[model samples]
Target: MRVAVVVMETSHHRDTEGRRHIERLAATLNEAGHEVSVFCAQWWGGNASRFEPDEVTYRGVTVEPAETSFCTRLPALLAKYRPDVVHAFPTPSSVLRAANAGAKLARAPLVVEWFGDHEESVSARAIGTANQFVTPSELVQTELWEAGADSDLTTVIPESIDMDLVRDVVPAEEVDVVYAHPLDDSANIESLFLGLAELRQKGWSATVIGDGPERDTYERAAADLRIDDRVDFVGSCDRERRLAIYKGAQVFVQTAWREHFATELLWALACGCIAVVEYQAESSAHELVEHRDRAFRVTTPQEIADSIVASADMDRRTVDESLAEYDHAAVVEQYEALYERLVDEYGLF
Candidate 1:
């Protein structure tokens, strides 16, 4: 089967969960004997408006930039590629419009991966144009249904992690808590700082991974809480380093106000860390560690601190076992089945 994955940017240009998801999907499809191509902007070289076309092979997937602009060049690109199915990531209204036009022009089924919330008006139009919808969690699917999308055409497919990256490292002799979240407003960094302050007496240090606009603000807050010395702001690091941090830490806390899938939470579980996630409206962290023994959902800073203290001596084997269903291989098989079903229904073969 020939598949065209449409996204605004690739991991080559930006490192985002959405781009990684698309790349992994493309790689998995290619490995499964399917022809896969990615249509995106040449964001890596900072040349999105280059007159000449930009093309490259990234992780065994062919990436072709939409040269003129996604809106203007996508239709022609789709016509040339002639894929059996067009898989588009939910980006912006303009891009989704282009993807819809391109899919229509190529006479291929359109599958839109809705990862985040969009304006209701824009979502209605995009959903109307898309043939199928794929969301990472039931919370997102519910949003699509409320936007007038056909429930039958929408499916919940959870985000997956590369289990091979889950290294078996012994926890460091020193007790440390790990919090891996982009220091963004949505991450609720304030709550985490407050929680860490509450646990100051426990003498357990913390390593806060990831970097963002709110880094300074959170750092200031940590100082105000008087836990600055105990918390280390390591900023962003490579995947290997992140896994090592998770493996060495006794607990992982997620204080995000809302998350569509909470990939980091899943990663912590896979790395054998005691996971504690703040319960939010759209959080899927509960899905990963349903049992209270493995993970806890907290609502306040006190609860967060308390959960960490309680989970300090817990075993990580059960939490790791719970993530088998979200392994990359299992996720790839689900996507393959979805693609085959869509292809047969649309008579694309």
Candidate 2:
């Protein structure tokens, strides 16, 4: 099947969530043996648009970059590609509208992928497209139903992970704890910081990986809390380097306030961090960590702190066994089935 996936623009420097998601999905379709192409708008951030390479054929996607709008961009490209399915995972309202218009122009089967609340605002504007909705978690499916979509037409397709990349992981040895991402409120980063602070006071060391808008702020939070000496802010780390960090981390922490898939948590598990997640009841984080016997979930920083301290002394073999569920091959197979379903639905020839 000839499939044309569309996105508003692409930026190499800051490969945002959607960019990475699109590349992965397009590759998945290609892996499923479908002819895939990407039609994109050329919107370079903080700079005037310049066209050097408008056509890029990579990852089984023939990318066509143009300065086109919803009225013209996707429709014009679809008219040219004439694909059997027009799949668009729009990141924003305007962008999704453009893709919706483009899919209509192509007159092909439409599938809207959602990682968060998209259909809530876009459904009324979509007019009436016979499009199936795909999401990585139940939260997204519920959101789509709330947005007036037929629940039957919505499917849950778990995200895929490239376990091969994590295969060389040294697997943390004696490290007490590991926390990726910056210290922020939404992620309950403050809580994690406080939890670590207490642990540090009790003589535990944690490596804080990743950077964000609140780096300096978080560093100060650690200092103000008097746990700075116990925490190491390693800044951002590429996966290869991160695998080595994971090698010694006995505990993995993710404090995101909300998550559609909570992917990094899985990666941490793959790297041998006994996963600890903090989430609200309604969050998708709760959905991902459902088998809590394998991982622990808490609602308060105190709970997190207490759990960490209690679990720190947990048996090594139990920790290792718990993380086995996230092995890359197992996760990838879930995605493989999802792609197959999409292909079957569209009859990608």
Question: In model 1, which regions exceed 4 Å deviation?
Answer: 8-16, 44-69, 92-98, 104-107, 117-123, 168-174, 316-319
Worst 10 residues of 1 by lDDT: 53-62
Residues 1-349 of candidate 1: C-alpha lDDT, one tens digit per residue: 8888887666666666666777777777776677777777655444343322223232111234443355787777787788889998776666777888888778788998877544324556766888898988887788878878899999988887777667444434344578877878787877777888888777778888989999998888889899999889999987777877787777888878777788888887887788788777767667666664667878888898888889876764423655777887888788878877887887854
The TM-score that candidate 2 achieves is: 0.80
Q: What would the per-residue lDDT of candidate 2 be over residues 1-349, giving only the tens digit for each residue?
A: 6777765554452355546666577766666566777655444343423332324333211223432334354566676677777777644455566666666666666777666633235655652453677777898778767877788778887666556666655554466778886344555568788777666558788888878777888888889988888788888888777777775777787787666676767666666567678876555766666775647888788878987887777654312444445554554465455545765765653
Over 4 Å off, model 2? 11-15, 43-70, 91-107, 117-120, 182-185, 317-349
Tell how far residue 327 is off in model 1, in angstroms.
1.7
TM-score of each: 0.84, 0.80
- Model 2: worst 10 consecutive residues (lDDT sum): 54-63
- Model 2 RMSD in Å is 4.8
Overall local distance difference test of candidate 2: 0.64
The candidate that achieves the highest lDDT relative to the unseen native structure:
1
